[model samples]
Target: MSIPDTASMPMFLRAEDFSFSDEFSDLVEFSFLPGRDDMVPWVEYSGGLPPKSLWGDSICGENTITIQSDMYDFLDMGALSFVPSDETLLKILETAEHNRKCPLDDRITLGDDIPEFNTELCEYTLTIARSITETIFTRDPYTGIVQEHSPPYPDIPRFKLTANPWMVSTHAYGAAFCHRIHLPLVQRVGASIESGTLPTVFKPVFKPASFRRNNVPTLTCGTSGSDVA
Candidate 1:
């Protein structure tokens, strides 16, 4: 089944706002149905999933994902050491400062000796800095094909901070990043598809017959509708 064009879809919706029509319910269910073990071979092969980080076991307590002090210090220095050609990082910092809940404003008056500044605030700041750096430095997969494609680093000037400083600071940074950077990249992908300019590397094709799951017999392609025979 073909996916609907998202350009016409609403930007946001609440769960209480809408329900699937009865006629389309079955189609939706079928579309999302979990893949059967027998049908695995019919799918195209992509690269293997990334290995889990070795540091996964280290994080603990309420701040499970918080960055370690030494790492946070390194990221902090990295963020401040180099200025981007644009004001993106400055704007990010400005947005964080204006946020009443953000630790920035508080940290400014409290001097450099505060414990939270060394810990929680430091972690949040490092996260934001690393995210922005990744956006600016990463190369596009289809860089040559999409000449117009560029990173729309989120306009931090227009960003608004929420009341809960820690949560709001992190969330706002992420939302802005996605809205500015990731969304445009996705739109570029769709444009590539529509224009039939997608690179050959991206085109999906069937995997070899030798591809097996748990030593099971592979099903024949384009026949018997996912049966094992």
Candidate 2:
């Protein structure tokens, strides 16, 4: 049977806009691996989410609304590290680093300094020194700055999350493996340039888009596994 058009239905919903309901929260917990006891459990809390001021200013700019929701509110932020799949990817990044023109005072390049533990699962140790506040989005305008590198990570399209959160959480493991890069390097160098810091760090920057919605007012959510920055 064909579904009828309902006036009350939401015309559209952006992937960034989502609910933090009890049922979805439970699903988020279930999606985690068995031994992640260190990860905090989702609690049933009332009232609204942490203030907009708490997340700081919008990435889009001032006056525009910026909203973000994570699976674990109390997640410990630290350096995210992973080994390159092969020498080709590393070579591409190294070439990009050399080609980019920047003032010497503001520039920091990894060059040929591939970590000794580059092949293993190691934490990007440098991130430990940075404050948690530094990692999140902020008020600074993006200077249209970009570096040329091979497609190091897969496209984490927004529309993908509209499907079952379980699928996204599961695929996040795969994405983590695929998305691995030396983010600590980005963190250190960005700290020098005002516009470089936050944008270098991976974030779900919202954009204007349109799509149909379902009946239930459900929210999009996922596990920390997807955060393979």
lDDT of 1 by residue, 20-128 (tens): 1211111110010012211111111110111111011111121122221223332223331111212322333333233323332232321123333222222211123
The alpha-carbon deviation from the true structure for residue 51 of candidate 2, after best TM-score superposition, in angstroms, is 28
Residue 213 error, candidate 2, Å: 32
Q: In model 1, what lDDT does residue 124 have?
A: 19
Supply candidate 2's per-residue lDDT for 80. Answer: 18
| Candidate 2: tens digits of C-alpha lDDT, residues 24-109 | 22223222212111110110000011112102221111111112344233221222111122232333234334323443334332
Q: Pick the candidate with the highest lDDT.
A: 2
- Given candidate 1, what's the lDDT at residue 138? 17
lDDT per model vs. reference:
0.23, 0.23
| TM-scores of all candidate predictions against the true structure | 0.15, 0.18
> What residue runs in model 2 are displaced by over 4 Å at the alpha carbon?
1-22, 25-76, 79-92, 99-229
